[model samples]
Target: MTTQTAKNKAMTERLVEWDKKHYFHPTTPLKEQQAKGPAHIFTHGKGIHVTDVYGKEFLDGVSSLWNVNVGYGRQELADAAREQMMTLAYGSSFFNNSHDVVIRLSQKLASMAPGDLNVSFFTSGGSESNESAIKIVRHYWKMKGQPERKKIIALERSYHGVTMGATSATGVPEFKNMITAIAPDFLHALPHQTECELGDSSAPGYERSIRGIIEKEGPETIAGVILEPVQGVGGIQIPPEGYLQAVRQLCDEYGILMMTDEVITGFGRTGKMFGVEHWEVVPDLMSVAKGITSGYIQLGAVMMTDRLRDELADLSDNVFFHGFTYSGHPTACAVALKNIEIIENERLVDNAKQMEQELWKGLNYLQDTHKIAAKPRAIGLMGGIELLADPDNGTTFEPSTFAAPAVVEECAKRNLILRPLIFGGLNVIAIAPPLIVDKQDIETIIATLSDSIQAFEQRVM
Candidate 1:
């Protein structure tokens, strides 16, 4: 019975009304939603699809906001949460109070994280993970008695998160437009999007960008550089080859910490355990979330290196302060453990590699077909098809045209949903389907997106 009954129908409408009237959604186009009620009153989900209140099912091309790595409605995860709730739901992790689940999860993360990033600090989600990253970076520097090194550098088109600290690091203006306040000393650098196109002769390769920023900001004031190896929300912008290595060398040269925000590219989303592996680079710190629990529960973690840990221990006899009340929540930890187990047992990461090929192939075919001068950019299961304004001229449409949203709406008409990234001169449809997505799923998504692009092209012409 996917259809809502008369009673359920009445309640559903009421709930939609309540949501519009009271729900304060984050990162949402609030004014538009207030006028349109709700785009989807989703009620049920399973595998890679979700059903709405009207019994309409749509392919989750964006993986329900780029998470749900193991797909939706996993019984195993639910069971794990249930068991943990029944056994040990609430336990204080503060003041050295701890639990077994978090300890084990930390050990697992230590084993998985690159380099000596052996410590795990928990948070409620990506925003908090990055929020913690900034604080920990500064606190680590402070403990070193170099309190002046408070500035952070992140790449343009890089998105860390939405918290004050994270928002300051986010490169997209839309994420920061509403905020009247932000943390000071957050700097920006160029992303190596043209490394291949321009070859090594590019004026600002990833290395030069970081070095130039450090030189201008005075490396003494810079604490670290934080960026996504695969810029997910930033149009799934895949960093050029050797980009991570270049940035790593610069950070080492400047005695600055290198941090990777893997909130969107972590887990199996990038066809690797973590996004940094694609470039074979390890950083002093890493912030991760999203796929950590496959969106079953709210959870995030930041990994710290042994060197930083030891230094902080040596310098600070005083207690260090920072953490959320739900940090290492027992139930969330249990679900995360189960989620990882499912990924391994099902071999979702390997599946992602196999499926990613299908995705790119479909995207390549779709982009090449419509004479729209589209570029398909992706890594693993995450990527997008970017539409250009003039195919022959390689120019982008003016911002007033709303090209990306038009594609989004056209695709929606075909029962395919995608996220539109229309910021900082990027006009593309971003997608990160569940790692369990198959070839047919890829074909459908690509076909629908292609049709949308064609429709947009006609309108523009």
Candidate 2:
């Protein structure tokens, strides 16, 4: 090997050693990480790809955790962050204090948000955003003298975040099982039971639907109904037509607030600027993150309707008593403003909408060519392909087989990064590349994934 190459390899080895010794990664197997070091030490990213320390580049099929809507290495966002930091290195929004950039970002988000969601409360990320939304709804009911309305009903298989309240509201068993005692009053119901949600008691899972849960627990005790417009980490399960609308109506009928977590589906990730636009359903409260700053900076916000904000304002004379130290952080807001500008100027939302057709075609091709590939689904650029041992018979592989992860590992070997959603006995391969991806990029992803699936098939089937 060349002298520089050998030196670089030595440095990478040292870095890996340091990482293994010090870094405790989130959502990773600690023992495995200590044994094998990191899977990849990413060094640089541009457009739809990220390069590792070993000089190997791979297509980021999952947008580095379903964010990075505008792709990577955008100088515009960096410039914006730098400018804001230089002007106001650190400013507190506490005690009614606010900065210019935060004000501008709040207004921008208000304009872009659905319905009358004109007020903004910023947080650092999705978990904080969700935690804030839960608090806002519960506080609203408390201020209205209905303190008993503290229960939160979320859909089964939904993933909100890791914060205490978020963890309680999250329906994914694995996430909640991480802690023994989750916050009380958080309930989960069977998801996508549209007929049951619409008051059809004859539906198969009626008793386990959101409506049934509300009825069983008494509507007056429920504070809000929170859900993702298109479930993300819960296997990218897209709801059926009329499902969101039905939930909206159900919440209205019971006078319970409806909140949608747009952490992964907001800011043009799902064709429209927001996922709720697909059904034209306007939620009472919306929590958003991820695409807000395109993974360039940490930022998130909980948006509520003007009516709700005004109600809370009129009802309480005391302070809101809730906010993060980085709430309305100037640098993060600046980065987010520029990120939104990039998405708009480049018409990436339109691109995502147009590319949905291409992604659908590719997923269908995978299903047709691979016997294990089944139940292909896509909305905008977010999609997934489920693997089953017998598609015709609806039989799944044993969980011990680790079907989806093996396929995703093959994809990684082919220099294309993808995520496998195997929680709750699923074998779903998630495909949500950056919004900046073109038709060719999608084709490359599909071809690589096809070969990867074929490799897995050859091994097991």
Candidate 3:
């Protein structure tokens, strides 16, 4: 064989070897992956694009697992890490002792977060952040002398995290099947898509339905309700008009704490500083990560309003009793501080607002010509393209057929990485480019996705 042929064979063999040995991927069928061998390997990234080991570049439409909002290879972030490491690598947030970086970051977050949510409890990632929030809400109720109000009401298809406690909060059945008797006090409300899928007006009816579920569940037994402003993994399902406001009203009336999981929509990913800002709703507690340090360092936080914090404080013996070893690590906090500075200085949040409009328009333009597209939802830099078996009837393609997955694979082949969201058997291709993505990059993503869907249609149909 020629030299080029030899190189290709060597690369393919390496991948096969990797598959045979060390790699246990998440949310994937192990047996199927073992049969298929190693998947695509990203070697490097610049701006909104990543290159594989084979030197093929692909648009990073998913932004490295929905983080990396500031994009890749930011030298300033690297410098911030280096500087912090040289000074103080790590420190515990235990007892009354803390680092300057951690203190400053907490104060900054308090100021930026909506309402009186001034307390910041740091965690290792989104999962832990959510886990902490769960613990805090439960503990707060206990402090209020209502330990019976331990139940948490979350929406179906809502994703909190993966830790045992946070996983229990996730309403998606697939994530909870293996763990039996997970959490006793958890209840799931209907999601916003119920009315939309049933071909009814989704605005007022959807809001009323969710409120009815909360009422049926008896708000007295519930401690809190957790929801994503825009469901990320749940096919980017945006709630209809007055949905969030109505939920807020119901929560207030029932004395239930409102928790917003901003793990995927915080720090300018949603064109604003946070996703809840879009609806002008103030959450009693907010869980944030991902863009906290632009994914430069491992950090997640739970912000609590003064009301909840005061409740914890009022109890003389209230321990609250939860923390991670790496909570408020000094170096991570320093990096986060610098990352926030970059975001503010570069005006990336404002850029996301503009890019969001451009991206929505671009995707809508494709929908006019692409028959497979349905229910295109776009807000800020986050969006989703629904793939339908019958666009006119809004019927979904079967999961076994894997039409959405096929489209994703085809897009990958054409050097564009897109994620397929499967919820209620509907396929939604989630599009969340980095906040730094430009008009040219948006054009490329749209063209690539449109072509991929067309190619899949030609082959599958």
> At residue 28, what lDDT does model 1 achieve?
78
Candidate 2 similarity to native, TM-score? 0.99
TM-score of each: 0.95, 0.99, 0.93
**Candidate with the larger TM-score of 2 and 3:** 2
Residue range 1-461, candidate 1, lDDT tens digits:
45547778788889889999999886778898898788888889999889998889988899887989999899999999999999999777999899999999999988887778899999999999999999999998888889999999998888998889999999988888888887899988788634522334446453447666677679899999999988877787888777788788778878999999999988989899998988888898899999999999999999999888888888888877988899999999999999999988998999888988898898889766877638887788988888787767789888888888888999888888899898888788898899998889888898888888888888887
- Residue-by-residue lDDT tens digits, candidate 2, 359-435: 99999999999999999999999999999999999999999899999999999999999999998989999999999
Backbone clashes, each candidate: 0, 0, 0
Cα displacement (Å) at residue 196, model 2: 0.7
Global local distance difference test of model 2: 0.94
Better-scoring candidate (lDDT), 1 or 3:
1
The local distance difference test score of each candidate is: 0.86, 0.94, 0.85
Ranked by TM-score, the better of candidates 1 and 3 is 1
Q: What's the true lDDT of residue 216 in model 1?
A: 69
Compared with the true structure, model 1 gives a TM-score of: 0.95
| Worst ten in a row by lDDT for model 3 | 193-202
lDDT of 3 by residue, 1-461 (tens): 99997898798679777865788887777887788765677778888888876788889898878889889899888998999899998888777678888999999999888878899999988999998898888888877888888888788888888898888989777789867768777777777644432324444544435565555666667888889998898888888876787778767878989999999999998889999988899999999999998888899999989878877888746455688899999888988988898889999999999998888888897789788887888888899988888899877787887988889999999989999887568688999988888999899999999999999889867
